[model samples]
Target: MPSSVEPARPAGHHTPGPPGPAPATPPSGDGSRVIPFGRRTTRTGRGRRTPQPPQPERVVAPDSPQQRLALDVEAWFLAHQATLTDEAAAHVYRTTLDFLQLMLTSSHAEERLSPDEYQHLTGMMQVLRDAPDTL
Candidate 1:
């Protein structure tokens, strides 16, 4: 006959039972239904729908007076390339060439100068033409 005490099972053996239903979630404090984890909640207030600030206008006006003067100085250096002194002229020539090349490369087509820009360039040319040998 079998003994009253049950024998111990081997290391990995076990009996299976019926699966239980999933646990119910707790109610929210405000009395609204609670969502599951990893979900975003909808915003409640109208303040959440605030509009963005307007962007600034972009104007592409021509270059300013100082820029025109710089160009004029550059042109004077170019026209007097032969007269530039050995000490100063080489450096000035290289720098002016670089500036002129950059201006030309950036523009899609050659831009016509304003009357003021032209006057500024011509005035600079006159000064270089009349300046003493010391310059």
Candidate 2:
């Protein structure tokens, strides 16, 4: 009895013509496709793209020294908002703001803080001033 098997093609050999059509249905004039999810269209597709609710804008403090200090402290806090959860971080923010308030009121603001405190406060001030540029 003869074997009912065909010889295999050698490696790198292929019987080729134009490749088969795409697995996906092509889009129509209205941009619809016959997908399993249903008749999907670019404009009329039923998906989870609901409109987002608008958030209320934060009111900025005024330009006076005290207000400016508070805004700087707040901006620094917001930038590092994740740090707020730590008790030590919260204490640092509170202490820095309090000292900043006192220092801003003095005629010699620079003299009021130790060198390290003054440098930290200046860094926070820079953060607030540069916020618009960064964002």
Best by TM-score: 2
* Tens-digit lDDT track of model 1 for 6-124: 78456455433225653476444854333335645586676776787987644323464444544565567668664344546646655665566455444423446655665565555
Q: Identify the runs in model 1 with alpha carbons over 4 angstroms from their true place.
A: 1-82, 109-135
Model 2 steric clash pairs? none
Per-residue lDDT tens digits for candidate 2, residues 1-135, read 223286755755643423677547555664433233554567765766888899866544457554565556557767976444456765665566567656654623547667676667667655544333222
Global CA lDDT of candidate 1, please?
A: 0.49
RMSD of 2: 17.9
Model 2: how far residue 35 lies from native, Å: 64
Q: What's the CA RMSD of model 1 in angstroms? A: 21.3
Which ranges of candidate 2 are over 4 A from the true structure? Answer: 1-110
For residue 62, model 1's alpha carbon misses the true position, in angstroms, by 43
Lowest lDDT block of 10, candidate 2: 126-135
